[model samples]
Target: MSDKHSPDEKDPHDPQGMRGGLTNYGDTDFSLFLRKAFIKGAGYTDDALARPVIGITNTGSAYNPCHGNAPQLLEALKRGILLAGGLPMEFPTISIHESFSQPTSMFMRNLMSMDTEEMIRAQPMDAVVLIGGCDKTVPAQLMGAASAGIPAIQLVTGSMVTGAHRGERVGACTDCRRYWGKFRAGEVTADEIVEVNDRLVPSVGTCAVMGTASTMACVAEAMGMTMPGGASPPAVSSDRMRVAEQAGAQVVEMARRRLTIDQVL
Candidate 1:
């Protein structure tokens, strides 16, 4: 019996790392050849490319303070993926901050969801981590992930720390509304309100209270879309970074197990 095989013969050991979803260039071999050639330009060795690929959505934006910790989260996630024997690939998607978007962030949620779904399908990844912190962003990512039908997980940006105002621990946006009401009733001076403004958001993160962002975080956790205790870590805390790392490592395992999103949802 001959042990030799033709180059065109499918390799039984080929996992869906860089081998999945070949571009329709009318030739499978050429598609893979060109894909590897282009990816190699990014300094990825063939060995690194052989590992399961984990896609991560980067929704960090300068206009979105809620996701300001995205860069740190990205680094932690990559570290975890590498340690777990997977390749992490971060890609940008549409970001919608509630306070910054015109006509409201809700209007843009579907657009972001579509972007997430299409990107996951277009990219070559065995599993994906949806990194988002905004109110609409979490749901948008999940909606897209469900549609994409791959192994998907959600990693929230976490909440903000409480700030102090006049010896009282306060933060947005309940406190913000309280102060505005006080100013309207002549209980607070312009200078006092100005001071309160700085204290409402002492750090860059989502609302400290259980507002939309935090609510959605809990929702994802409850729906089994996120790791255990993935809901309440503050953005600046080391715990959040640990959660990010753990989520990264878990997603790689999910990829290896072929845990599709359909199984979860």
Candidate 2:
């Protein structure tokens, strides 16, 4: 810890030395002390923050249930990173649920990607874990990570569980559209439509379909950006949490190896 440095001795946490640009304010011992001072406000002991820093991209909000499990996922990731002798820090970027953004979610996608890339480059993490789902989040993260050139791994928030309405199996926007179509043709009553809405999304997660979110998750695995079987699981399932923890531990190894995004590509 830079907090423990003795006078007349070099501060090993210098950015050019061990911290790798994280402590780049200056090479002086007082510069290291200044960096550690404000960071201590987060209740971190010098020893904890002294370890390699792992950044977590948190793209969750109340408006986006697709990323509802982000906090749980982040906690699990932090546990594994701690066990692997690393410090995990969570930061926010723009969250884009398919139905929330105006003027088109696609229009907002490039902006989110730019936000992700800039934040990753500006932060002090040695490596990053991109946690996202929803329609645009995954690709935006990929675009950002690719440009940032940092060691990065992507984790999907997983799908929502299938719900039930009037004793029939119901999924997400797929089923939602089917029922709406019937209503539009005057074949179903307004009352039935309202009832179906309540049962469509059983839990907090992205659309439970083979749409963009799930497709990107699978693609990430195929491209070696995700762990084996990481693409398959409900967001609320224990399996998703387990995979998140594993991602955290794995990123530490990536940092140790100095595996930049170029290496993965």
Q: Write down the TM-score of every candidate.
A: 0.94, 0.91
* The candidate that achieves the highest lDDT relative to the unseen native structure: 1
Clashing residue pairs, backbone N/CA/C < 3 A, model 2: none
Q: What is the lDDT of residue 106 in candidate 2?
A: 97
Off by over 4 Å in 2: 1-18, 22-31
lDDT of 1: 0.91
Model 1 agreement with the true structure over 1-265: per-residue lDDT tens digits: 8764532244734538887888999977788889989999999887788788999999999999999999999999999999999999999999888889999999999999999999999999999999998689999999999999999999999999999988999989899999999999999999999999999998978899978888999999999999999999999999999999999899999999999988987
Worst 10 residues of 2 by lDDT: 13-22
- What C-alpha lDDT, on a 0 to 100 scale, does residue 224 get in candidate 1? 91
Indicate the TM-score of model 1: 0.94
Q: Which candidate number maximizes TM-score?
A: 1
Model 1: lDDT of residue 180:
99
